[model samples]
Target: MTNFDRITVDPTVMSGQPCIRGMRLTVRRVLEALATYSDRNELAQEYPELEDQDIKQALEYAAASLDDRVLELN
Candidate 1:
C-alpha cells in the first residue's frame, strides 16, 4: 500500500504523527521494533494485531518518505 493509504495523520492520535492504518501506532514505533528485534515471529507474537507485512509496509513507507526532499529556490 502507498504511504498515504497506510499512514494517517490525525490530531487525535500521537499529536498527528504519521501512524499505520489510522491506529495509535506510529510509523516510528514500528520501525523501532523492527530495528531492535531479530525474529519476525517473535515480534508478531508481541503485537498480535500486527503481521510481518505491516512491519514491511512501515519500512517501505519510511524509505519512501526519506526520498522526499525540499528544495530551496534563490
Candidate 2:
C-alpha cells in the first residue's frame, strides 16, 4: 500500500472517512472543494490551514483507494 502520511482515518473523526492530517476535513470534502474552486489560491483562501502537500496527498490517497480493485462485469 502506498504511504499517505497526510491522510488519516479515525472512527471518531468524520465517521472514519479519510481525512487530511487527522483534521476535521475529509478527503471527500477536499475533492468536492477542488471541483468547486478551480483556483488554488481561492481554495487556500477558503481553507487556510490546508497546505499544498495536504491537497496533493488527499488526491493521491483518493486515487490509490480506487486504483487497486477487481470488478465483476455482469
lDDT of each: 0.80, 0.91
Number of clashing pairs per prediction, in order: 0, 0
Candidate 2 C-alpha lDDT tens digits along 1-74 = 66899888899999999999999999999999999999999999999999999988888888877867799999
Candidate 1 lDDT over 1-74, as tens digits, reads 36456778899999999888888889999888878778888778877777656677788888887857899999
Instruction: Quantify how close model 2 is to the true structure by its C-alpha RMSD in Å.
Output: 2.5
Error of 2 at 64 (Å): 0.7
- Candidate 1: residue pairs that collide: none
Structural similarity to truth (TM-score) of each candidate: 0.76, 0.85
Per-residue lDDT, model 2, residue 64, is 78
How far does residue 70 in candidate 2 sit from its true spot (Å)? 8.8
Q: Please tell me which predicted candidate would have the highest TM-score against the true structure.
A: 2
lDDT of 1: 0.80
